[model samples]
Target: MIQRRQGGFTLIEVLIALLVLAIGLLGMASLSMTSLQSNQGAYLRGQASMLAYDYVERMRGNSAQALLATSPYVISLTSGSTRNNPDCRTKTVGCSASELANQDIFDWWGNLQAAIPGSGVTVTKANTNEYQVVISWTESDAQQHSTGSQTQNFTLRVNL
Candidate 1:
């Protein structure tokens, strides 16, 4: 009598195939997690860059006070302090340069604190028409893990 061979895979073959599939899925999951973390870090960095640029523009608009040695433009805020309102937002009346500077700084600082975690900013005069805007903030979890630095800084030089 002739016997017919089964046309199905053995139990061991099925188990091996399942094991390979599981490993591939695990690898894909790890890759996706890393991509998400990197994207978050990039987003935070972009926010920091924009904040620094905004601060520079504020100083440029109030160039008079910005050039003064003891100008409000040359200020630093890192402790997340609550600033008082500058009270110069009325469109009917005009504000002096110094008052405008105060308003700008107050508004900018408030924005920084609200937008960035552990944020700090410093504006220093480099020359007669050149100034440096330095902004610092805490990095996201992925950045901290990869770079070993908890904080990051962005600097901009403006000439008014």
Candidate 2:
């Protein structure tokens, strides 16, 4: 008597293969998520850098007040602080150095908040001609194991 042999995967073998594929797909999905979070963090960092540089440029433009012993540009702003947008643009004679600094800060803070929500800023005089600007914000895409959203900061030091 001759017996017929089947040369195909068994039910158990197919099920095991499918399980492995599912696990691999899950791993790929997890990697994609991590990549997205890293990209978002990087984008926020870039925005912070741009904002800091913008402030630096503003300070440069108003170097008279920016280089003062007690610079008007030196300020610390909380995330919830209400900003005042002075209409320095309407001044034909041009605003004072302090007024320019205030307007600059107002515009910078507004851009920072618009770009990255829940953001705060601090500008400190590091030296007679140097300043340190720090931009801080909360990242919503932080790890799931953390107690809350992670706070990230970008600092830029400039010398005029």
Q: Where's the lowest-lDDT run of ten residues in candidate 2?
A: 140-149
Best by lDDT, which number?
Answer: 2
Tens-digit lDDT string for candidate 2 (4-119): 99889989999999999999999898888778888999999999999899899988988998899988899999888877878799879888778888898888888888998888
RMSD each, Å: 2.9, 2.1
The lDDT per prediction is 0.80, 0.87
Worst 10 residues of 1 by lDDT: 140-149
Tell me the TM-score of model 2. Answer: 0.89
Where model 1 places Cα greater than 4 Å from the true spot, the runs are 2-4, 90-93, 141-149
lDDT of 1 at 129: 75
- Root-mean-square deviation of Cα positions for candidate 1 versus the true structure, in angstroms: 2.9
lDDT of 1 by residue, 16-118 (tens): 9999999999989878877897786777778878888888888878877888877778877776567777688675687888888888988888888877767
